[model samples]
Target chain A: MADAPAAERAATGRAAAAPSRPRRLGRRILGGAGRVAAALPAALVLLFLAAPMAVLAISSLNATASLAFPPSSLSLRWYAEVLGSQEWAVSLRLSGLLVLLVVATTAALGTLAAYAVARGDFPGRRAVAGFALSPLMVPEIIIALSLLYYFQGLGLVNTIAGLWLAHSVVALPFVVRTVMVSAQNLDPTLERAAASLGAGRLRVFWTVTLPLLRPGILAGAVFAAVTSLGEVAVTALVSGANTTTVPVRIFSAVQFELDPSVAAISTLLMLASVLVMVVVDRFTHLSEAL
Target chain B: MTSPDPLRPAPAPAAGPAAHVVIEELAAGYEGTRVLDVPELTIRRGEFLSILGPSGCGKTTLLNALAGFVRPSRGRISVDGADVTDVPPHRRGLGLVFQNYALFPHLTVAGNVAYGLKVRRVERAERRERVAEALRLVGLEGYADRRPRQLSGGQQQRVAVARALATRPAVLLLDEPLSNLDAKLRREMRVELRELQQRLGITMVFVTHDQEEALSLSDRIAVLNGGRVEQLDTPERVYRAPASRFVAEFVGAANILDGVADGGGVLRIGDTVLRTGLPGPERGRPAVLALRPERVRLHTAAAEPASADAGSGGAASGVLGYRAFVGDAWHSEVHLAGGATLSARTHAEPPPLGSEVTARWSAEDVIDLTTAPAEEAR
Candidate 1:
């Protein structure tokens, strides 16, 4: 690193000392080339991520009733149809309720667990944190399969409560991770000051600790909401016909045939997540939680 | 082992153990490390007692124990003659000011000050009165509506003090409250805290690592080392005659020299014999003498006699190694014969480096720490 800086300094000095116009032009061209070389991979990554969303959007606008790239003609018919369809609307509503339930459940549970993991000292603390965060580490397919069997044995496989539990379990780790980051950063002295100022334990947590955790709570809620909305495999296995979520419905619909309305629904789900994120970002800086 | 009966009736606080806050046989630790074990500490009502020590010396733990923040393994703490060892922090009714001055960021200055009153369920009118009175005590009356983050660091600490005082607790505990402020602010807050404690007539226990702060503001100082109080005395006494080696070295710039006590009114350090009024060890017993740096005077001497009476006691021949003038005083590092170095401070212009000089000190200033046990210092 030391030699590289010295070499760069020498090169710059030589370039400055050179009186030739051609040499200066050559160095400028080389600098531009190096800049492009470094940015090329990032540009390609952006394109790869955006291309599918663009394809999904354009295909949703297809005038014909088929899923094809570079749609032949543009039309809003699929959007209207998707919005009007009963199954689509029902699935959307079910997903919305489930997402709301998961966000609320995970945020509360995550904030409590994060407080324990970050601040409390107890026997088997590591074991408890690991158990709480197991879903994030283990394979999702295994979690889905195990939960499916468990729910089936309880005869709640098609129930909204069972689906809520599964989605909440899956999203719990994300919420805990975000909230834990904020919890660890919360100075213990603040709590001490509160206690010394005659605030009881419950009052301190409610008035002092909870208010400071607002950013973490909002960030965790956003993560859990988005994750629950887009969840597929677990929701597919646990959700019954009566409790069919949007992702579960989309998974089953793709098996029989391709519906352009699926694309429209996907766009709508993405838009809902974006709207949730925007609202949360208005209250707290999202990057602070991470 | 304790030293032979203190030579000068070692100066201490006028008030004895009859105190408003009393800690007895307190022992506390965390995760197997013993942090504090105070047999007894007594704080008189309306007295400013500073617990001065280096970091991890359990000064903070002692303050926390008194505040009911740290549970003792075995002890009893009584404030206002009421035992409160098992009491919780809020019920203990001892106010604590944190090092960070953790004023609630969400609350305005008035709201922060009124928190303790609100938690106690004081009526609206009384709460407002107490909050305003507290702010006025800290000279922050106009800043009632301002947020904590909007105030300067000095202002924030004043607010913290105001918040702690609003509860009207018997004893207020301050844990390094001025540590986060700049030097000037720290000095300013020191005066403010002392004045506040006096004006309110509320006892204050301050924990600090800064000895100057302790010396200037405290009526009595408890010098702690390795979770134990080495000495509890007036600041002037502690500075003039530290009870042990730790206090002598930790409190101020001290030049400790190896010596052997004679059977007379003198102790011998290398080739030099110094006069002493202290009742030191027996003849030829190993002894350590600590002399304050400012007490040592540097003189450019040539052809000095081997042994002669200098100013106060005697002088030792040495070469000034490095000399520089600080804004307040002239400082010079002198190299002696036995590969030991001694620092001297003089108000006069310092002699040049490598010049032969004699370091002289008064016999009265020689601290005899030979019998004072050396506590483990972190």
Candidate 2:
């Protein structure tokens, strides 16, 4: 009975001493230094992303004939010039058509391939899936060079169809990867339940499978459209004199002259990319796609 | 056995149309490993039959075969006298409710219920009416516009049922439909599902590994093991008169005792002779008896103090090993002199451990089997 009181006293003393030590140390070190450590890098990353966009937006309104930071005058002359140009208009039209075609074809082919790879069980399924997505592993320069030689040999050099095909090939892997991730996450029992409910194969695909795949298809289409619109490496190889996309035209202009027009055009492309990203983020969660 | 006269008026509505589903000589496997080998099974029309087994017992494989997901290597599956061996799942006109209640996430509750009718090219107005009627049957009439994600788990399950019933298929298959819910919810859903089936008079096949679920919901249960039906009988028959040791052990908890027959309708375990109501095997033959725990009575004193010398008292002495309170009953494990243990469930609080107690049971409660030798009884 005497030993019990001593033991109880010691235990209570230890319990009271234990929490205060950690609490005081946390307040002195982690509560102060740890917060600074967490916040500094996050602040740096945010500034790094925002500063360039802010400078670009401000410089776009510059009235000077040459590109400069902290411009003396602000005007919309560059915007008006870009919009008034027939060359820019024609290139914009071509880019629009290319984006539309690329988005539609990539989405259709990618969804089918994704469904097959993720859900279908057949011989050589893994090998076929790997082969379909192998384009992403190769460097863009290698793909462009190979396609250039291949198209030249086929007598399809410098044609719109050649550019369309090349862009689709590069864009397809992204769409397929995004859609396949979503498809793999879906529950397969849903398909079985659909079948048992008197739904035929086609009906099940349309009613059950397609609705669940909408977010994936939307994300992949946006990615394919944006990539096709701004693609340069592959477009450079296959674009003819008569068929010049906005990126190819901008590349040529930059090579010839260091002028504000290129900055203006690049700013336009940047805005378009941001716009497409925002639209995608609105409909489909970008984090889920990632 | 003499066949009943065909000319005589049949009783009880002719056994409810004579077993519409006939599965004959079915052998199925996955990736060259045979999983199911059911020789024959016949399910009567409008019957709520459950295939009960443990995991890896191929009960799900049997259900999948009936659902047309698995093609048997050698068999014929017929429904209403028509061979459906070559038919695909959709063409077989069967309704299935998955364990997770796989309702369509994109469509509203009404759209999901109308999917089958629309597939069959029902008129738009008629489709709407049927969808409304089906939802009403499941008591979800006003939830037609809600997507599956908007509803609770039980509501989603009801929508799945409504969708399957809208098609009016020849059979309904449920694959552990209530396994995902909480215990209380599972109980309520079981009652609701059983009531719905009886009200609709639908031929339903339910698959589950839970023994209580099988016994409570099914009119007859086909207890399966190793891909074959061990016993197909009414729940009471399967529970009370299991045809084999496996059935007796798997259906309910049974304490098996090894005994030797004395060729005079008597069996002995150690020095205790048992008066088995059933006939004994040949002299010196090995046998086993299954005794349910609830049937055994426990007494604090030795052989009631007055009937110790009488062999017909059906009493045996053992030491109380452990006692546990199991809500409405006390479960006691008693160890006999020969190191054998017996479990008995009693209404009274069990005696303390290490106390000497006598276990008593009636002769009619002992189920005797002579199929296997004593050492290999299990």
- Encode model 1's per-residue lDDT on B316-362: one tens digit a residue: 66789988889899888988766667889899887778898887767
Clashing pairs in 1: none
Model 2 misplaced stretches (Cα beyond 4 Å): A1-33, B1-16, B262-279, B302-314, B372-378
Specify the highest-lDDT model's number: 1
Consecutive 10-residue window with the lowest summed lDDT within model 2 chain B: B1-10
DockQ of each: 0.70, 0.74
lDDT of 2: 0.82
TM-score of chain A of 1: 0.91
Candidate 2, B1-378: lDDT as tens digits? 022432222233224367778889999998898889988888888888999988988988898899999888989999998899999998889899888998878789998898889888999999999999999999999999998999988999999999999999878999988888888888999999899999999999999988889888987789888787877877776777666677778887887777887766666777756545456678898878888889888878743645543344245678999999998899999887667788999998877899888887776787764562233232
List the per-model TM-score of the A chain: 0.91, 0.87
